[model samples]
Target: MSKNTQAPIPDSYPMTGGDGDYSYSRNSFYQRAGSEVAKSIVDNAIQENLDIKTISSSVSRNSFYIADFGCSVGPNTFTVVQNIIDAVQKKYQSDGLSSQVPEFEVFFNDHASNDFNTLFASLPPPRQYFAAGVPGSFHGRLFPESTLHIAYSSFSIQWLSKVPEELFDRNSMAWNKGRIYLTNAPNEVSEAYAAQFAKDMKNFLDARSKELVAGGLMVLTALSTPNEIYHFPVSPEFMFDLLGSSLMDMVKDGIISEEQVDEFNLPVFLASPEDMRRCIEKNGCFIIERMELLIPLSSINAQACAMNIRASVEGLISKHFGSEIIDELFGRFQKKLEESINLVEEIMTKRRNQLVTVLKRK
Candidate 1:
């Protein structure tokens, strides 16, 4: 944990409730943003010529073990899980095993403090698969070794286990003052964030490698920035800049102190495809089956895009700064986003990219 963090960093943030304070459940913006990328991963996996017999041989039991890492309180997760289950069932039928109905054990995993009640209660009644909640960080082991057959995560791995600690030390050149995230920070700050992401990805892949049986599959979707473009008009990093500027505005207005901004750094990183490929190769535990950049986030309108960003970070912000300032802060954020969009109307038509990665356990 960073020494400057006002609150202890959880493995990930939680989104729950339909009230005005926690509107993630009611808002469909995030689901809309991630839907295409997730569907592509599932569809592409099904299209692959997977040997059902070989995959089934690795597991000892008749039941299939599936886990959704970082399954927040959102409806999109349900659709993604169903798609995976359907693909598995289709493979079984194609192998002339349609007579057998294998029990499906689905696990929803997130940080310890995630709102398990809301997530579980919202489960589809009379569900086809057995459901259970597994609370732990995906950066470490959460299940017994060789116990899982399939793992899926969408729009989640971008979050680091915690903010880079070097950013907290006053003497460190990586101290990310005047910015809450690594959006427009100096070269040193960006490098520090990349280092932390590499470490976390290593831990994530190592743990998943141990838990999943040989030949098991893992699919992940995450936000990424364009390498050629420093600051694209409609990128995730640009949305982050709007957020950082909002906090600075509060500081100027005496609504919040500048030290508060300096002390807080977001525990998130937008990894590029090259970064992921390098990490996977270094781990040597998983074979990269497919890697592609999915739908650009800029396809969504600026207002909806802003809402998607708000749904993701509101929980983390409210936790640090009290719930009192939530409405005012986002209200300012929405207006600023509109201004930014109008300024770059011509360039805004381009895509804001995301990465979809597929790996098989070796």
Candidate 2:
């Protein structure tokens, strides 16, 4: 296993809860689409590499633990886990171990503030596996040693444990005075963010390596920055800046202080494929089973697009800038979006890789 990481975990909040028009449950179309697009790759990975004999022999007996990290309140998480269960069941039957079919248990993990009530309430009426809510940072230890057999994460893990401490210091070049993220920032600001992402990914790998059993599998689909890109405003790199423009507009109108905008930055970083490979190899405990860039399957309109960003970042923004400004903030965002609505259609479609990867515990 890689050395234990001492990086601080993010004090992040959950996605906008409940099934409102702008709530995460209603607006996570891109995430849901990414899961659908990656399912076949995941199923094939499990079918070809699950090592059922070793799992049956060496892992916990008669029970398999699967975890979905960064799971927000959803029917999407439920459906994804069910798909995984079906694939695993198929593997067992193919290997003639149907007689010993293990009981499946799923752990839906997210931050402590995630809406467990909504998540549990939305659970499928007749789910095959037992369900549990696991609350904690995925970048740290959340499960018992050698407990999880398969770990799945879809369109999450972009968040840094926390925004880099350097970004907020006025004396530092990485202060990121006006922007909400490092995407279109100065060289030093971008470098500081990259350094923090490496730290968070190290901690994530360290924690998962310890949680997963021998021959365990981990499957993930993450929002990623492409190797070559010049356009694509909807992708995260430029997307938040669009909102930041509104925040600056509010600053001009004396609605909020520039300092408040300066202090607020999203704790997210889109990993490149090279970033994933470097972190996994340095961890030295897993085999890189698969790593490929794929596009999301679903599509939506420009208004759904603005709400999508609102749904994901609402909670975080509300916490920092006060809940009072939310309506005004997002209203301005929508107005700005309409002004230039001829941008990218699907989220991150033009230039994002949307990296999908599978790793096996060694």
Query: Against the true structure, what is each candidate's TM-score?
Result: 0.91, 0.93
Best candidate (score: lDDT)? 2
For model 1, the superposed segments whose C-alpha errors exceed 4 Å read 1-12, 16-21, 228-234, 296-299, 342-349
TM-score (C-alpha, index-matched) for candidate 1: 0.91
Clashing pairs in 2: 10-161
Task: Report clash pairs, candidate 1.
Answer: none
* Weakest lDDT window of 10 consecutive positions for candidate 2: 1-10
- In candidate 2 the C-alpha lDDT for residue 110 amounts to 95
Model 2 spans > 4 angstroms off: 1-10, 228-234
